[model samples]
Target chain A: MGVSVLQPGLATTVQDVGRPGYYNVGIPPSGSLDQYSSLAANLLVGNAEDAAVLECTYMGPELRFGSPATVAVTGADLPPLLGGEPRPAWESFAVGAGEVLSFDYLRSGARAYVAVSGGFDVPAVLGSRSTYALGSLGGLEGRALVAGDELPIGDAGGAAPGRSVPEALRSTHPRHREIRVMMGLYDHRLTDGGRRTFAEATWRLTTLADRTGMRYRGATLEFRERVAPFGAGSDPSNIVDAPYPIGSIQVPGGVEPIVLHRDAVSGGGYVMVATVISADMDDVAQSAPNNTTRFVEVDLRPGRRARRRRAARLEALREALA
Target chain B: MSGAGGPGAERAPTVAIRSPLPGVFYRRPSPDFDPFVEVGSPVEPDTTGALFELMKQFFEVPAGTTGTIAAVAVADAEMVDAGQVLFTVRGS
Candidate 1:
């Protein structure tokens, strides 16, 4: 089957789970910022959890299918339409040959995932189909989908019947703007007042937010002039160089928190004070500009358990649909 | 000098450089650009010797020591570990 792009959204690219085991080479595991949503979309169409899907940021793309296929839309609800009629999200649906698929303005969430059976037929780069725009690799020509681009869709045989996401899983989709963070690698470097201000103050998302990192504009966190302390195993540091992970929060000059995301760099000089827990990263990804965010710290043991529980529930939901 | 935390009681001065965050290390700014600094180059405390570009943002590594560059440990366009040595400088 084939799919043609009529209008590519603000930035739409194919993404999977991400490329791993290359962080030391400075290549981030660029993939879906919201893995939960991406997996859900794929599972809706009976595709593997890591299948490539169309990731639409803010605005979405317009496309036409060449052959009948089963597809699903997950992540932030973008209010998609199939052939001029409204299409519901978080469930599987069928599209016939020569049908047009369009999306309107985002109703909620910063991005949405579109998964088709057999997945998007895109070349994988470094073991992933996710696009890393800076390196200019992966996805459609290693960049965002453009108008007039034709994408081949693999045929995963015939379509399975449609399925719905469980009510419990659906309820967990984050609508609030609050983002939970573990106190960062440099949490101690900041004065008591600085730490309190960070926890208490409400910061608005600046236009600086993007796939690489989210920059907040609000109270500036200050630190003692001496070199800030470094933390162990993926924690932040004052040393001008270090490896970075998705959800790593870096504070430079003791002010303004930058939350790294899917496309974030491998290392740098800022003090990473906290890391957003995995379970809540989707909430951070779907945050729109101007949304207010507050950071809260949680211990790692409990945080890991929460992530496992969420993952198990999502898997159970996918199995139910199957 | 003899007071609490005074000069006479102070520990020896040792320069320590650490990784700012985790990312890939590029010695030069881009593929075509020359490296920012080299061995024996005079560096101030704030001079950026190299850069680590994560995602798309570029974070510069400041010369933490005011001296002549002594050794270049990491190769150009290499992956560096957090707290790994990139260079050494001998204080003037």
Candidate 2:
């Protein structure tokens, strides 16, 4: 049976690992902002790591189950409630038929993932069940959840309640974070002092943050004065439209710095100063507005090592749960 | 807690209004506008006292109980956590 939406929270949508190999056609790889959290929720519920789960933003949704099922809530500190009683996050719990599941106020982080016993049974588009709301592409009708909407649940495969990730392997959300980046693409566009400020000065996360991009405010960056080349705009920060990789940092008008995220447009005309390493993308996703961040530069070798360490942590999580 | 009043009447208890989500709390809708409420301002259950900005979206924080504003707890543009008290009202 399916679940009925009693009240859709701030921006709840269904997401999975994401759809890759479609950026060449202007479609972004829309997926969970915090991939580790999403995967952890899926594994806890005995579903495939790529199974679709509900992504709740700062707020959470209220739903009524149509049948008995196992459920788990992960990512953020949003507390889950079953039948109006408190339930631990990051651990599986059982919900009976017609039971209502809700959430308390978010205590930390920016988003939460909800995984049912059998995952959400939405049809996949472009090989993904993730929602790209801007393009109306995938997920439940290519939009966010609304009141009265019924979400289908797949067949459960032996998931049990009380399974939880170890505390050591769980992620933490802090008010201030230091994110590592690789200074390469278009770094020459900025002056030496500008580069130092980018690395040294603390940047505050602005309210203009979402799945597509995150904007930061702090010291103003100065671009090296240059004559506009053919096809490039007159602004010193402009470049002939180049492909934007996920986690790339771009500054427009030398003011606010923006980091492209999972649902970012494939190509843009802004000058990219640095790229956040893949290992730290989850950290960036968890950042809330008003949080402070500092950028640290790293080389390719260290970046690759961090990625490996992250993978190892995931493996540890799997082993612990097993 | 009750304060003595004439003929067995007691002082009204103050109710705290907390934010529903974490964000930057603003007293005004924008920089150019006046604050939505101030101390001593009367309010209905649906009255909005402040706005919380999250991911560039503004959510109005409504007063859930009919009361008179007794205190404003947070300053404009201050970062607040979820369930943080924003205002205190004395029921009418």
Candidate 3:
């Protein structure tokens, strides 16, 4: 099957799971920010969990199908239409040859995923089909979709049998406010008051938020004072460089918390005080501007257990549907 | 007045290293360690002298020039604005 972009919205790119094992070379694993929704859309269309799909951001693209095919939409609830008729998301549907599929401005979530019966036939780069825009690698010329861009699809014989996503597996749309996080690698650098403010105060998402990271405006966090000795004399000093990970919260100059995302740099010298759990990453990714977020601490062992349970549940649901 | 130029000559513009984003600024690599670069030390482009952490992501700001560290404009653990001067490097 063949698909062509008519109106390329805000930022649309092909993405799958991601390219891991390249962090040591300063290359981040660029993949779907919301893996849950991406996988759901793929599975609904009978595609493998890692099949490449279109990741639409904020706005979505207008597409035309050159041949009959099965497709599904998931994530962010962007109202998707097939040939001028509204279609439900999270379920597979067949499209006639020469049909036009379009998505309107997102009414909810910041991102949406579209999957075809046979995944998008884009050549993979370094073991991934996802786009990393900054480095100008992967996807369609390493950038967002543009008008007139034709996307090839693998031969899938035709539309597969209809499939339904389990109600329990279907994600309830996340709230824009209140993100959960666990204390991170550099939590010790924060002063007692700094720690209290982080847990107690609510932060407002700023317009500066993006795929790189989310910036917040709220209470300023402080670090314990230190002494810097130059030659012989010691001058008062505070602030240190440290490692970071996805969901790390760093308070530079003790002000404004920035939450790193999928495209965040691999390393830097900054105090990373906390990391948002993986379960909560989807919620953070979908948060719109001006949303309020609060940090919550959880123990590692319990957190790991919760993650395992969630994974098992998702796998079971996928197997039943398959 | 001290130069050999004619009267009413304009003074040279003061050069400064600006902050890339608004956040807390630090000079040292860690609490228990010495800073990567200090006053009078030479720095080259791509030199990772310091970093700024926002939320939890740390962004490294390159020196972008080969020069002697002239002065430290922002203090350790001081809040800074994007594009605000953080250091003054005299080109070598």
Candidate 4:
């Protein structure tokens, strides 16, 4: 007994914390865009934090449950509907056998995570159920869900319904966000004005966002004039191929800047001016098309502190759910 | 910016069609395509009123009710917020 997909959402795929320690080998750590939200959904359903969950994009799927199970929806503000009745987000609820579960239009944020009682019982690839659709690696046959696909559910557990995350601890997605970044990697390549504009300008996210990377437009960045190196391309922003860290910001042609995400290519030739702070990666993931972002530069001290704060928040969720 | 109680005030009862998600709203599916709806255009509940490109996905926004397009609320390719009215339709 499992969930039957009636109408697959825009891009529903199975994902967990991710398959780490494999980036050097060309496999990205493909997983949920917002790990905290995913973990919260899993914890609320009494599943392990790394249990595979459905990562729904702008739209959500229409599913009919084959058996009774506890369910939770978190991340985006996309509300779940059970048998056409509205259910709250960030809270665990129940679905009876044969009940249809659907979702309303996304109200905020860009992604939502759906957690089932036993999690989606999909075979793990490279120790992860996470889907890297580009390479067709994991999840159900390694791609987004389609109609008639029956997702297997793990053995039912004792997670009770009505458990909800505290409001204060919940994630909020505003239209305009100020994301913090650590400047370094290729900052020296940008002119003074380019650096100032990058720090001061408000960039609007373009529709070129996916698991791979998110592209933004607004102010144009100027690179310092330099003779082309033998190994690099002629474009001022080009450099010899180098490993790209997740959340790195690379501007191509000195125009649109793209921030690589969880499923990013391991190495690229573009010049990455800065990296979004580790703590703010989720925020980057939540950004929707046309949403404005002002990148605030921060030093390693604050960056590490932000990471600690995020860890503490996760700890608080664990305590509350426990 | 298309809604009732405007410069000349309301003359007829109209219904507002709002965008369900935040994104760049396009009046036409693409630049080469005609606008989905226009003033005086008759529409049904399932009629595609507009499109919003979010996260590289183009999602169609249904008209939701049978009516005649009375006024357009936003310009082509305008960035719209969730729940922001995109069209006002007069019930037939």
Candidate 5:
């Protein structure tokens, strides 16, 4: 009838595709970090592409099923264990009543999504189950799961046991990844060397990653010498606060670029040198600390094309499972 | 896991301590502190052998199985991936 929390793991939360159309109102779209993987988990479980699922961080949860259930684990390479037996990722499986489900250590990627039959049965905030912890909005009270909490299970209707996603279509997270970005907005503020280093040098993801934003370490960026503009701060990287687009990369103090994610502030007063394209953002979320990432700049056409390719793959995934 | 390298009450002859996440593995608690466990050191299932750091947070690498430190697979402050064995313990 429900999943009882034996151990809540590192950080597990209920999330969906996210609450769109409200960024203008200062509400960050706090959804799954890896959207494609989230969708696949949901699809395998016979839920909608955007159905709510649990996003587990470095460690995973220990749960006992109160009743028969269908489940799927996707995203990170954290393999699921049922009654101490290994279960494959990216596939649907069955759990008998009273069976315990846990996970192994993460092998690749940073987040893992768990999709249950029917879904989380959590109430949606603003038409979505995503959690925005900063605002304390949505998804099981808008925070990470804790021990002793019981989660209601949705009515089961997802794929049968042994149904799995195609390997080619399944996304994999590598230790080193070249993420696509679009430069602009404040590239003029950077000195020529700064721009070159940003484009040429590799950056390492820092543990400063969460739902709000992720930080990276690398060569320091230099800004063009300029007097502080009205409403702008004295730091060369400071500017009149502006709305921050999701995936915008802001470097403060000329070092450690921060990429805003699904649960970031709506606006900020920092100079944004680049924006990670929509299609590749999932990869950015999956990047673990110590993982090297190079921001590969791309044109608008390529960005849009990447989005289309993702949509096509998802459509094919639905068919594959069906 | 109840058997075959799983962590449980029954101890295996040798226990493998692995990093659960990718990060820098620190043998000592701090630069000034002594290493958590050295070779031949007795340890319990819950005993921590090392610290794995990532994103500025520290996670303890527990023995998970009771034994004595048999070998250190990684050096102090070495970067390791998840599932990478960090140390081995010989059980009673």
Candidate 6:
């Protein structure tokens, strides 16, 4: 008797596959900004690739199903629907009891995930039920999916509805996105025409973005005037605070840049300049806000072979949804 | 309203609504309130009908159908995005 919420789109939360170690003290590891389409919607709802699910941004919530479940709708292309008909999106679909599910509108990526079967039980916190709604920490109670709430699910795990995750392990989102990055920590505080205007500008993604960082706006980058040090603040893009990493990038007055993602806060003081490469943090979480990225500039052995080709495309989408 | 084959020649279904996210939008709920469902009123299905905002949070926008307002399509504070539309209900 769970999955309730009736309209909580635009930022619906819950997510999973995050909350790693606690970032020294500040916390920031929210989770599932497209973790390969939230692990192919938990392997097409049979669950267990980190469970928890939901995520939906660029709109899609409305849920209902207080009984029969087995859902799936992976990242973006935002289509979903069930009691209202039109289903299929990264496959797997069933719902029933009071059915509903909903969503439509956002064509092409920006965040969608969903999953359902047994996951969404919501509890983990530091170990990760992953919502981190700005540190309120872990799913549900931490916030986001509003309208009536309910959620609960967690029992079934054998509902693989049709499965399907192939199309080359699916993951496209592109209205121009490039992404990649690697450069250096604080990128030597910039120069060399500010890291060539931070790896030759193009940026854009800005409506500020969400899970904590994204900002961008076509490059003004330049930094490198130096002379601040002791506690470093005088903005040559500051620095001295450290940590960040999830996809880092920072830039501050050098003009816009931001990129941090997955609820990042872990550490700051600005000055990052480059990092983005955990196999393109799911292409910077499906990019969006006006999309138009481009950071490029890799190395670190092609960012560890693009994170072992995104872990062999999530182990071939868990053996093609097993 | 069920037309396409008789009765008063029907009509109603209009729907639209949109703007589930990207900021600004707002048709009131503040700034000395009042604007929530105007252009002909009625609304219902969970109510609220407009308020997106962003970065400064806000959210609401609901009006999930059961409608009447047939036209508001954004303006007060504008901005919109994430599907756009903003209103045109008629539905019921």
Top candidate by TM-score? 2
User: How good is chain A of candidate 6, measured by TM-score?
Assistant: 0.38
The alpha-carbon lDDT assigned to residue A185 of candidate 4 equals 97
DockQ of each: 0.01, 0.60, 0.02, 0.46, 0.47, 0.13
Error of 5 at A153 (Å): 1.3
Order the numbered candidates by lDDT, best leading.
4, 2, 5, 6, 1, 3
lDDT of 5: 0.87
Better of 5 and 6 by lDDT: 5
Candidate 4, TM-score vs. the true structure? 0.94
Residues A225-295, model 4: lDDT tens digits: 99978899999999988999999999998899999999999997899999999899999989887789999
Tell me how candidate 6 scores on lDDT.
0.79
What is the lDDT of every predicted structure here? 0.76, 0.90, 0.75, 0.91, 0.87, 0.79
> In lDDT terms, how accurate is model 2?
0.90
For model 3, the superposed segments whose C-alpha errors exceed 4 Å read A156-161, A176-178, A228-242, B1-92
lDDT of 5 by residue, A101-188 (tens): 9998888999999999888878888999988878989988778889998988877466567778999878888889999999978889
Q: List the residue pairs that clash in candidate 4.
A: B2-B73
Residue A168 shift from truth in candidate 6, angstroms: 17
lDDT (10s digit) by residue, model 4, range B1-92:
33333444345568999987777899998899999999878778999999988766678999988767888999999888777899988765
* lDDT by residue for model 3 (B1-92), tens: 22322242223333577764545677887888888788866677787667765444466767877666677887786665445688776664
Task: Name the regions of candidate 1 deviating beyond 4 angstroms.
Answer: A171-175, A227-238, B1-92
TM-score of 1: 0.73
> Per-residue alpha-carbon lDDT of model 6 for A169-191, expressed as tens digits?
78777778788888877787788
lDDT pick, better of 4 and 6 = 4
Better of 3 and 4 by TM-score: 4
Give stretches of model 5 more than 4 Å off: B1-14, B28-32, B54-57, B70-79, B90-92
- Which regions in candidate 2 have their CA more than 4 angstroms from the true location? A156-158, B1-13, B29-33, B77-79
Give the DockQ-based CAPRI class for model 3: incorrect
Query: How much native contact recovery, as a fraction, does model 5 achieve?
Result: 0.64
